[model samples]
Target: METMRLSSSFTKYSSLSSYSSFSSSSSALLQTKSKNFISLKSVFPANSIPNGNRNLTIVSASKADDGPQQQQHSPFWGGESFFRSVLASMESVYLNKNPTAKAILERVHSVDNNQICYDHLAFRTFGVNGHGIGSMANFFLDFGYTQREELRFPEKKLKALWFSPPSLPVSDGGSGVNGPLPRIFISELLVDQMSPQAQEIIRKCTEISGSGNKHAALASALGSLTWEKPLYSEFQQLARESEYAAWTLVNGYAVNHVTISTHHLKSQLGNIKSVNQFIEESGFKLNSEGGVLKVSPDGMLLQSSTVADSVSFCFSDGITESVPCSYIEFAERLILPQFKNLPEKEVREFHRRDGFEVGSADKIFESTSKEQLTRRA
Candidate 1:
């Protein structure tokens, strides 16, 4: 609902003419698109501006609504949370017609809270990270739709949803720490869906990154994210083959690996059949199953069924690591806790490891075997 402005997005070093002449086929690697328009008969029926022929619309929040309505949402917001509803409003309509959004990712060599906030906004589509698409976990699971633009009923749309944890909180006045030193969670989605080749490239990136080889994976991914083809049927056929992974998470708000594994993440990994293969191939040694990742009184991943295993992800260099099963078991028993043998209860209760040092490798890996095992993942 703000005034539209021209954006000087980052472009290739080559001339604009060169980019324009680039091929539009993503069968192999390569890429390069908006959300607006409103119609009850259309996809994004909320906050879309009217354009007669094209599926591009920009509807103001005020105009999108018909009458004065009471806003009913959680007041748990700490002035940092963003809550945009795609109700039968206009904004949702626009994004629906053009689900594609431009993504820009950076190493974030340093802390930038403002940038982190902006990045969260940018992830309105695509996702917060490779974890999965971003959405209000509970709400969208109840009302979200997917791939309907390409697939038919009882298939694309479902009771699935996504989640994005809160941005890193500021721990002020302790050990001389200040703003944005250890909090960043921004995602940059491409303006177009990646081609099959691009998907393969990302897969390779995941593999290479997992293996601790990132530079090559980054180059490969950047060069292969094109979506210029018009093979809807072909893509649909591939989709029918199905190859993705799905893991479970407990809560959407907590960043703890135990609580962050939302259902959306599970489906995004690999499809149903491929997931089965991956599980068997990877020899998934779940800490606790039956869909729980909590810890027990005995200090294990399970405790009288009160604890369960949940999964999440974090990528560095090029590998996107899927932290599966009970994070408690992984972080405490398998992975190092980065302390002088301090217990997790003490670590958490005292709010120690307040900087970028806690998530360091020394804290994440236990032994040579564990490190090697993680790399193979």
Candidate 2:
């Protein structure tokens, strides 16, 4: 529950996952965000992380004159972990292309790799309890090309690698708790020398010969590689297809993360407005309306309204047995609808007559996605 996990938050939820046909978009978004989070794994010496092309690594900041301030307020917190995740991911991509030619490399090939990546993070999520994030996001940081590329490594010459999150907060009063350790870690082993067949495959894959230009693809694929979590494109496609209304998409990459983190912000998400209003839950936002809000169907009181609050009621005219919150935790939960349908105009008229302002003639269920995006620009 975004509101509960963060306690202090929630954002708007425009619709439900099953509002339309069930789509794979939710899974895609989960996977994509997980991929971005894994991007921050770093091999740099001691607490350093990359910010874009610069060595904005944590070590450099720590070495800076800030002293205790830096120690007390380490950069890795909440969603800002996305930045760290991005750095980790970049290193992974770099390794993907420059696999020590002869130094050997490792790989991951299926659900098997999932376990390895999980080991790297040492983090576990049992369900989609946070917004839609939970267990699906448990191993995001060690996934992607690092684990995936292991499948493409030179046969017989494969490397054995294991990793875990170096970022977990230090335990309070542990056995000889050492100095702050990294959340980025990877253990490696070299396999037999590259096979001639494997070498040839690499040559073919990296070929720059006439009619075979793979460098461009490689460059495009690896360029600006990051671990920062992202909203998957499949999620977008699904949202478009779902009956759920939306407000706007968030572009967390551009924001000053040291102040506000993408993950921290995203943590505020709820299934939809009706579930709960947790802002940082999903980075989703509305116009001037406190970003987004969800009101209980029975919670509304037409009799309690005046021509004053500039509010109105639009009834779906169905009995809604909605669960308290639809965060992934309650996956098996269902709500039975029990009401009659009414025309949009009649619902609007009743609401206006009650006392609230009806949105424009075009908007339905009071969604302001267009307005929010337009104003965001």
- Which residue runs of candidate 2 sit more than 4 Å off their true CA positions? 1-136, 140-287, 291-368
- Mark the regions of model 1 whose C-alpha exceeds 4 Å error after superposition: 1-338, 349-377
- Which prediction has the highest lDDT against the true structure? 1
Residue 72, candidate 2: how far off, in angstroms?
15
lDDT of 2 by residue, 211-320 (tens): 21211112222332111222234223323432121111111011100000011111222123321223223233322332233222222211100000011212123322
Candidate 2 lowest-lDDT run of ten: 324-333
How far off is residue 292 in model 1, in Å?
Answer: 15
The true-versus-predicted C-alpha distance at residue 247 of model 2, in Å, is 11
Top of the candidates by TM-score: 1
